[model samples]
Target: MKLAAPIALALSLAASGPRDAETRAWWATTATLSNDAMEGRDTGSPGYDRAARVVAARFAAAGLTPLGAAGGWFQTVPMAERAVTAADLRVGASPLAFLHDYTVNPVGLPARLDAPLAYRGYCGAAALGDVRGRLVICHATRKPGLPGDADRAAALRAGGAAGMIAIADPGFTVEPPRWPFAYARSVRLATQPAPAGGLPQLTLNADALGALIAGSGQDAARLIADGSAGRPLPAFDPPARLTARFAFAERSLASPNILALLPGTDPALADQAIVLTAHLDGYGRGEPVNGDGLYNGTLDDAAYVALLIRLAERRAGRGFRRPVIFAAVTGEEKGLLGSAWLVAHPPVPLGRIAADINLDQLRPIFPLTLLTVHALDDTTLGDDARAVAAAMGVQVQNDPEPERGLLRRSDHWNFLKAGVPAVNFVFGYRPGTQSERIYRQWYRTGYHKPQDDLAQRIDWKAAADFNRFFFALVARVADQDRRPAWKPGSTLAPK
Candidate 1:
């Protein structure tokens, strides 16, 4: 007989481990890996490389055999880098110069494009004038070195433009500084094709636009004020010319899943493995934000990775006899790339893995007031998480931003997709309120902003508390030797 997906996952995870005392050890292991010097652990960066090395070393010290195929622990993740040069533009066979017509300021990403552009102004409020299926251009009213502008290009791509360029200066060419917490300028193509579209998008720099009307050699700000749609500029003296070159890199990084074997005294149960996972990478910042260059992300996640490390040390040589996998995956910030890759290629068989204990952004130092389970009330998993929270005197709630798709956002997504029993632990809001202020505030302030550096206001004790609470939760599941599963008829399959 075949078992249902959720049940199968529950059965496997239920038999993995039964360790409760090593929670602080787990915290220490993760904290050492999240040092501020790691620079928000940007994937492929020197700091990120250092962080990966540190994790491998710690896994070795913890008596966990390297699951990586190579003799050494490190699995080099291949990557490439390219610098941007000048950009060009052409409209109806007429050339548009870089400073004269188009602009580009996007995070590093690979592309095979030089598509047409459409002038989709303020999300298509202005007439595109046969500018579809091409590189689209739009205008931004915000200053250059501000936050929130990544979506400008994405909208264009979604609107059927092959690519997008956000022009901060409506007409001028002053080189503006990068914005902190800015939106992703790149666009994901929507399925709906453009209906007889034109060129791609071009967004002008709003702050430095006034200086553009006087032709070359003008302040960037002057262009924004003068280039009003109501007003017109002098015809091109010698006709404008446009040319731009964008380069980005990506590669196969053979990332490993950290594993430790506790070796159960009972021979039958020793075969199963429990998984405790957390993603190591965050969207790194290349531009300066609040006078900081790197996105340190001390509180956002480093704190939690620290929690896992501490817990691992706490449980060394004790805990249950079953094996445990302490997996710190990479590229989670980039759409859970590492975890997805691992699930497709697990060192252990997919069926032999038991429940997953996930710590996303643990912060329980000050007062243990609230806790959130991504799959709360969805199955026995919620009940298990709730029981743990209740015993610890912490309030529990279901994910507040289910609509935002947080349930399927991180490394845990891979485990869930593989039909492995998994759960993501996080704190989303105040105990009594449903507002997602915590997540939204983090997003606006440091989700990917350079301001994520470790500062005085960070509550370090929170990470410690998360370690203890997680220790208890893991024990509740592992010690019992029972699996929790998603409810039947649940539509919660990984997308």
Candidate 2:
């Protein structure tokens, strides 16, 4: 005898295993969001609008109430963008290729630039001497006690340099510099102030450093070696002059942030809400990598956004003790603009936001043995994350590589700045382990590249495990009596 259709389907799902079903569901959402038809979901593009509509429909189906602008599902975010349409550069008659040899920062660049070249080692305040009105070249280093990008920029600007050209460090293996930048562009919220008197910056391919230093009686190879090794280097005038012309195209556009809410069941705890956020934007078509131009940002962020949808669906219209906001934000690739706008113009009172459990930078390519928790000591939300991970037999550790500046890279940083306790996670691996190998390989090839598509390999079990952890953690934070708070003496705590 044949079973009824619903009963047979349920039996099939049970036999196929719950984890299998969940993985398929999660991947289905991720695939849809990152597919070619979505056109990479560039912020303010039609593709991003389509993706937002899909997310809004999913939220509605999951019984979420629209909590966006004007009682609709989307909060429109106005944006201004600038893109370099054409550029020409010649250093002592050596015409370097745009994107192939170098890419300008494209912010506050003059229409024309003609200046002499000065090799300022590290561009530190002490190393830079009489660089006024010259284009200063510096070695980009991440070593301890060395001047970083910000410090270098400040010193060059204060020293009255016309521009700054930094050689991309070749020795930083953690995140090796990838040549052939797609393009140079900058985007900001329309209401935000434009950068004032910013120095024009350029990043020269390390391999192209010789072109800039040729005929100066200095060995480019030796300088690179010493710079990469953090050794002392001589500063002198390179026998070259830079002449460049740039043309830019500017436009204004708007994208929507998909917002939904699940109200609390308990009146006492309902005033405090837990905010869950993930960005919905990805790098659109740009310079082709291996003949593929589309950057399907699957694990980079689309997958985490999918995880948010899965959590909403799993709730099945049930309310927790405290309300929860599901915010699929936009413009994270454009410097966290959407989350910033949301925090500034909140649907609910900013004070009601007790904590943020952000979903980004999570790659479950290997077994979920260890997790790196960002801001692990800054707030009580870290305690909730720790308890959730520990219950699943996963070890939690503080971010081991703070030099990457990941703490300020994602949407959670905006919430954290607003004094809402926030936490984010990364799949961790021990040194020299297979997990480390896979993790690093992904960064080199898949991170922000066209290769980060659905075709990439995924550990289904690990994905399911993270999804479970996220669900449990949200429940723990939403149902607990005490709202999440900043730990005393935490530097990130709001003054």
Candidate 3:
């Protein structure tokens, strides 16, 4: 059976010029892209390349001019590939299980490590008291002095520790979404290389951590509680030595970024472009979760890419002023590589890109009453979003979970870094409501997992409503007399 059978039906429905055709076409496109045949579209994989071809073909079909390399709709980017071949960890006499018990990323370290073990609460400089030769076990947090495990590991390495093991928070009711441990693959832009020096670091789950703290006088629960309560816990030496080893292979390959241009009708605004983007890649094959391995990513951007396609189709006859460039970028799951490459090597003049409206994983699981805007306060784009959303009876909101630091986590950040005003959209929920509970449940189970597929529940009406509002928002941005500019006093404002 053809993967796009449902999309074909949608296209036929759209041929009749019904009011909901756009929404139907959007779902059809999303369904086709998220089908099992796409193999989750992992960046730099054959699956992603295939997905790129489909997007480019759709862009051409929409009457948009191909603005990619050599008049093709693909802006190929060179990427460095790294895959872990083997990894193992042992504390005392117990061997920690991979994936379930612990996961290690040997990105910046040697293949093997062996050292005496010490429990350094939170891996802070003060926590590690002159432990120069011991491998350190610590907690990970977004706290100052030890912002993240990488920062903590760098600090430990500078203090002459052999390596570090970051204990995952035991209080987490749901296992945090993570990439596969033993069979992990990563891709990054070859031009922007990784940092060269840092100590070997591993993140251990609560179960694996229990093995190390077994014989120690210190209690694991007490240590975790202290960290959770923002109280300082004393560091101590563990009752065991640590041994770790991992081997990996590194290579370089190329990925594609799809670009199509809708030329502006007005002569004055034709040179400047409004870039609309969404990544078309996901986790692909990984450690099986709930007997499924493919991360189908129906919501994690197959839907948004479909929205980009629908946007191009909707504006085919409209005489918008500013050119709209729909970019289906790849390698976003792998450090936003495709968008970064696009910003660096733009198909059009770099300075001509006035703004970027990025759409990532947007799930309309509940009512589309609230919309979360990332980088909302950074530019006038937020104001434009508010006006359009209000007209559509949707409330516009700033990122509620700002501590998540979502502003820089998506592809829009690259455009912002290049001095272009940008914003990312997500569906939001009110606190203490059933909608909020549903959203949280989705994060705990479906997010980044194999379950994030078409079988999941979807509020079709909400999806359609958001699509309508986004289309209007894009039109507003494209036709506005003034170009998108950073708000005064915004850190991201163009200097």
Model 3 CA deviation exceeding 4 Å by range: 1-20, 143-151, 170-183, 317-319
lDDT to native, each model: 0.52, 0.88, 0.80
TM-score winner between 1 and 2, please give it: 2
Best model number under lDDT: 2
lDDT-based ranking, best first?
A: 2, 3, 1
Candidate 2 runs further than 4 Å off: 1-19
Q: Which of candidates 2 and 3 is the stronger one according to lDDT?
A: 2
Model 2 over residues 189-253: C-alpha lDDT tens digits? 99978778599899999889889988899999888889999999899998889999999999998
Instruction: State candidate 2's TM-score.
Output: 0.94
Model 1, range 109-196, lDDT digits (tens) per residue?
A: 2233444333344333233444454554445534332222455544454455555555553232222323332323322112213224
Where does the lowest 10-residue lDDT sum fall in candidate 3?
173-182
Q: TM-score: which is higher, 1 or 3?
A: 3
The per-residue C-alpha lDDT of model 2 at residue 219 equals 90
lDDT of 1 at 267: 54
User: By TM-score, how accurate is candidate 1?
Assistant: 0.66
Steric collisions counted per model: 101, 0, 0
Give one digit per residue, the lDDT tens place, for model 3 in 1-495. Answer: 223354564464345433465676787788778878788998878888888888988888778999999988889899887777776778766787767677766477577777888888777675678778887888775555444766687679778987788877644432343433425565677876675756766777655666887788777777777765557778788778877777889988898899999989988997779999999988888888767878888899898998898887777666579988989998888888889999999988889999999998588888899999987888999999999999888898988776566788889999999999999987898889988888888977788888887667877778888888888888899998998888989988767
